[model samples]
Target chain A: MPHAIKMQDKYGKDGFVALLLESQGLDASDIPGFMWKRFPTNKTWLSTSGDAPFQMTGGGLPHAALVGVDGTLLWEGNPNGAPKKIEEMVEAELKKSKSGWGKGAIAKKARGLLYGKNAFVDAAKVVADALANAKDDEKEDLEAVAREIELRREAFKKAPKVLSEDARYLEGVKAAENYAKWVKGNPEWENEANAIVLDFQRPEIVKELDLEKGLKKILASAGDKAPTADLAKSLRTFAKKNDGSRMAARATLLAAAAEFDPNKK
Target chain B: MTLSRLVRGVGMVVVLTTAALAQLKVGELVPDKTFAQMLNSDGRKSMAELKGSPVLIDWWGNH
Candidate 1:
């Protein structure tokens, strides 16, 4: 991690950006504190999980991969073992990249102008300003990103203002998925996409659904008959699987209710 | 622990260890997927917006 930060500092002016990916285990919200305590940097920290775009080839805590401005992998290894390799490769990559209007430089500048705020029109303007003197070859991608900004802006503006519990939950789910697709390759829009999904998964959305499923099954059984061993096992499994949620607690209660009373037995 | 369970646990570990070691190769185009979330000084960022510049992706964690 330190090696990566050092590289970012040394090569950052030459259009080198360091992205630290928090691979699994920790909650998304925990990243800032984690980075601050251990891996502090002005660079951004991204969380990658099951849907990670890149895969690791070996087991280790710190795996590094250097990608060129055109997004091709240029080097891959443990940074600690081959620190010189990264420096050499970045220099080579810098030479190959177009000096003034390289993709990486443009993307980095555009991202700096877009992060943390929600106004798509405002973002589009910022992006437009960054690209105002862009080379002819850079215009296409710049336009595409600007177009995406407008699309996302329109989508959010169109989202319904009021919805019932279930409808709201479903809408949130749909919106998150849609935004996820919209920003599929664009890291600049990841924060908004993350917020959408987090808001949708807020416990309340799944609370009623869990209660309805859990209680309906418990109430359907015949009067005073102890739940069969198989039913007890399944209910226990369900509760365990959903642990920490309200539904899980309800499932546990239902399981207890199904237990055979000693007096009756 | 039963011998069978112990062997199974070791086998699972080996399998996972092997899987974890498989990293990206040089020269391959990196996948352009959006990260779940981003932590940054200015705020969150997306991988998509990171094009045109050389990016060094460090996959690391405390746990």
Candidate 2:
């Protein structure tokens, strides 16, 4: 299928015109006259040639001026204050054609598609697809690659998330929570998740839960035995002191702590 | 002086032989031909073309 054309905001017509004007050391006012002349209303010009007259505008303009249909500067001025050498234009066109501008848009779309999903699952699908389609000679190596992708995906999936019912999910959730905390930012999910993860038996998860000195108090209360009950009590205490999401997070921590079992066989 | 000159000539021959051996020959297609095809479908054929001679098929990484 022909790739969809996504007009990149970075290469707008204004940028192209600006680049042309800057190169020529002229202003936008200098552009309208020559541009209209070369691309007269009666004459139908290719999109590429449409910008040729704008090249007279020199350095005062922005880089936005030179963007053309295919990213080639349709009107780069020569040293002599004329449009760039015909040979240069021809060479540029050839290079642009060979480079294929449509491919960039396609790649960008593909990248967006990949990043939009949960990274682990999306990456696994990509690897699986690659392996399934690999040549016979490459099939052997692709198995290892597929396995690696699967391993990573499994690790990510098993990693804990805030509010995850599973203990394993807490690991990933805790990491995300820590990251959010360190940034002095609180994503709603991460805050909620952190509360749940903090209720886990893991000391690291508890520490990052940032229950102030309550985490230490809970740790001190349960030395050898499970601190699950102690952690739950501390969470209730913390909840009483905080408001809004923090209160909710504390309540989740209390609930999660009650379910945690340090002596699970 | 004559022995040293002979040894130098032999050394040069050995170096030249090693260089020739290291040079990649034409028609050595990448084993991952299907990958090339997939990449080509996504508009990455030019990369595959650079892998060898004969048919210069290219492939590209989509982002």
Candidate 3:
């Protein structure tokens, strides 16, 4: 039986890339650019500016009371009290590590600016500003850029759609299968099999669909009252056997789950 | 030997003293009991819980 791996231990950068390639049919090389664009650096002055006041308060300055010019506090404290200052608070905050902010935050915000709100208008202005003093030959390239921008703008203007919860479970199941294959091909990864299992059986993912109950229902329908461990094993085996179609089916299920109506269905 | 050098040394000492006072030292944890309670009860607890479980905690600001 293929052991489960923890998502945190197994679903790291490399694992995520592998899963995207296997399940979403995305190339690892193509992923980096999309990931990068989706999560552009907060180091940029604009992104960093939004966080400066918060960081100041986090690092120990009473930004609201002390930093605020008005009656309101400038920055609210982390649910906890403010961080302590070792030296100049501003300098210390600027120097702190920038690893806490994840790709999701950047992606969500970038997507909002690019597709949500009036991102297209804002982008058009930026493009216009960039092309204002370009050479005559550069005009064609600028126009092409504008066209591409318009296409993206239209794409963003459309409603926000996310994968369904059921599809996500199937993706998790597919990821588990891929991890099993990778482990089989590369025996060296066997030591990390348990971590890999945990990754596939991520509590958050399971919690999203009430998977424990769903799996039980599926098992009950099949007239099998086996333990959860056995059911999980059976499901993993089924997913592995049905590879490609399973991934698609999983994606569909997830899309449906995302827009699921428990009251109706 | 020079007045400028003497003034620079005094300035360094004052700066260092202020920095030392601002910092939360190992021994100073006793003096700031409320601060320590807040840190342990509210701040550290969440981090510890996240570390113990496979949960993703996002730290963000409204501004």
Give the winner by DockQ.
Answer: 1
For model 2 chain A, give the 10-residue run with minimal summed lDDT. Answer: A1-10
Off by over 4 Å in 1: A40-44, A48-51, A100-265, B1-23, B41-44
lDDT digits (tens) for residues A170-194 of candidate 3: 4345444443433342244443443
Tens digits of per-residue lDDT for model 2 on A197-247?
A: 454556644544454344345545644443355556665665666545333
Model 1, range A1-265, lDDT digits (tens) per residue? 8887888778776667778776756654444444533433335444534235568667876788888765678887788988987889888767554332325466444433333233344456656786788777677768765765564454442342122222333444555565555454445666667666666555675674545555556545533333555665666787787777655665565465455342321
Q: Please, what are the lDDT tens digits per residue for candidate 2 over residues B1-63? A: 699999999999998655433422222322221111110011112222111111111111111
Give iRMSD, candidate 3: 20.7
Best by TM-score: 1
TM-score of the A chain in candidate 3: the value is 0.23
Worst 10 residues of 1 chain A by lDDT: A157-166
True contacts kept of each: 0.69, 0.00, 0.00
Top lDDT prediction, candidate number: 1
Say which docking band candidate 1 falls in: acceptable
Write down the lDDT of every candidate, Cα atoms only.
Answer: 0.58, 0.33, 0.30
Worst window of 10 by summed lDDT in candidate 3 chain A: A14-23
Higher-scoring candidate on DockQ, 1 or 2: 1
Kindly list the per-residue Cα lDDT of model 3 for residues B10-54, writing each as its tens digit.
Answer: 999998655533522221211111111110011111111111111
